[model samples]
Target: MLRWLRQLFNTSPLEFDESWRPELVSGFQHWSLLSQAELDRMEMLVTRFMATIDWEAANGFELTEQIKVLIAAQASMLLLGLDLDGYDDVTSVIVHPANVRLRGNRPSGGGTFSSAPIVISGQAHYQGPVLLSWAAARRGARFPEHGHNVVYHEFAHRLDMLDGVTDGTPPLEDAAAMARWTAVCTAAYDEVRAQGSPVLRPYAGTNPAEFFAVATEVFFNQPHELCEHEPALYGELRSFYGQDPAARISRPRRHHQHG
Candidate 1:
């Protein structure tokens, strides 16, 4: 009876395809930087993500395995040191062939909106599906040095929303960590709004939520630049995300660039 019950309760993890390894290594620049253990963990997350999320292709775009894996791998990277439940609210992922154009009220600036046909690469809705442009996602994965990844940006918004708020700050370990995060992020956000930053792009200054998402893009893509220019922000992100990307990446410093 005990053996029968054991078999009844048995379960298996999702299988990861070996063929996807090359696709990931070739498409994602950061794939080569992960340790063996981290790689194993990432594979687990990737498989689960690809299997769990409801993936859709807009405009009759062909949704291939390559697209799913590439997007899943990047999304999983964010949860490397965190729990998968952080994304429990995300039920679907919609991919567009290119930039999404919407003729609706869009945020202009300073707490206002304009009814213009705005083109966006990605968008994250609170407790809703994430929208991504395949062109932007593919470019961001293959060329991370540009410091603008739609997947990272949208998923970071999802993380920020996990606390039931769309503000820049995500859930922290404790009050002390939250305090430090606020201080650091506020300072950086203010600087970006005022004098502007070399590492962070102008779009980051749009709002606190966008700032966090944009910073996440730079934190992973241009770790060296962020570590060098905005050490405090980088340190806060490193502690919060539980990953020191600067240590994993080894590249000579170059002039700051944005995507």
Candidate 2:
């Protein structure tokens, strides 16, 4: 009975065709230059990713081919290690030109009409929807060295909220892991709030939810800096994420450069 019920609710991940344009970049060259076998693997990932999203169009991307690919790749990477790991709760992804126009300071508004610093490149609604600026996502993919990735930032929030709330806690696979994660993440959150300037980002100090998003940005962007500056916090992030970006930060990530 349980199996049948699960089957009834299961849907495939969100998958898009290979219609987007390509860019020539050394760092993210894999998206354009990966071998057929690798590309096939990426496609598989994309298919599983589709299961996680109920993709809707806001303002579709009008940017360069590279930007579109880059944004898709980052969103794909967030789902790399898990099955059915796309933004399952989200039914749509609204892509805009840049920092979306603000309707007000309300956090409840959807992406199509919102204002900001309004330098937000991406934002995750509490209900599991996402809004990303194609320009910011492309820029982050082009330059992953800096500590700013709108894709990672926003997607991380979605992941964190999977536990039924948009708190810093995401779904942990085990109690032991959850305990360690809580300890470390809480410590990091407190430190960031107290110091005003954190190893991850000042924005993380904005709130617990923002801390998760900002930490994700640093995790994918300034990994080594995060490790060097805040080794304890970095260790926690590494433990929770099950990936070590610092290792790749030092060397070129040919095998895992899709994100």
Candidate 3:
């Protein structure tokens, strides 16, 4: 069905074209999470974002361009530093107006000090499928002077799983980089759990998975603060992502906030 839709879209002349795409990708109303370069990367990630998503008009939900920008921005931000190579692993994203219902009696990490089981709000499986709620996605993108990005949170799982395990470690640039990332992230995560104040967000301490996602949010939306407060983590991230977003956020914006 997706291939059919792609062929049909390619055959159509009335849909969005690539020439004017970069101009429309922004989340000015609720997101200050992307740089012009980052946004352009998003344009590259999803100029055909709509093309890849299983676009549909569902009842009780209004999927707006703003929403598309929000999701694409978050997803693109994930790969702003490294080459986003494994995205074809998940060819479709299923979105609902709100959290979708996981199947009944689904257990979460059963037994061995993890037997508290129940359905989760959002899940990205190892089989290359992503699921999200429109409301969850919107709330996540609001950047409410807090940290928590649902899109990045779930998609981080996807990227981490590409190596055949969801252990919260994505493929790094080199072995040396991987060793350094683990060491630095572990130290930072432990520090945050021990004495670091909750400046970035609390979920960063939930686990390595949450740490990557939360780090991503702060890396983009609150770069200056992250840089100032968690210099080691910031430096490690600078090395990891290859993009200094804190530097980008510090520069002047050529465009004014129209709203």
Q: Candidate 3: where are CA atoms >4 Å away? A: 1-39, 55-66, 100-121, 251-259
Lowest-sum lDDT 10-residue window in model 3: 250-259
Per-residue lDDT of candidate 2, residues 127-245 (tens digit): 74688877777677777655677888888888888777877878887999778877887888888777754356566776778888888777767676677667777887776766676
Instruction: Tell me which residue pairs clash in candidate 1.
Output: none
Mind giving the per-residue lDDT tens digits that candidate 1 earns over 52-136?
A: 6778899999999999999999999999988552366776899999999889787787788999798899989998899999999
Query: Which ranges of candidate 1 are over 4 A from the true structure?
Result: 1-12, 107-111
Q: How close is every model to the real structure, measured as TM-score?
A: 0.92, 0.74, 0.73
The regions of model 2 sitting more than 4 angstroms off are 1-41, 47-68, 105-119, 251-259
Q: What does candidate 3's lDDT look like per residue over 1-259, in tens digits?
A: 4667665654553344454344233333233445666555555665545555554434556766656656765676667667662265665666677766544344333333334344444667676567777777666665434455677778878777778876657777788988888887898788767765445565577777767767766665566667777887788777767878666554422211110
Better of 2 and 3 by lDDT: 2
Candidate RMSDs in Å, in order, are 4.6, 6.8, 6.0
Clashing pairs in 3: 46-49, 81-241
lDDT for each candidate structure: 0.87, 0.64, 0.63
Instruction: Give the C-alpha lDDT of model 2.
Output: 0.64
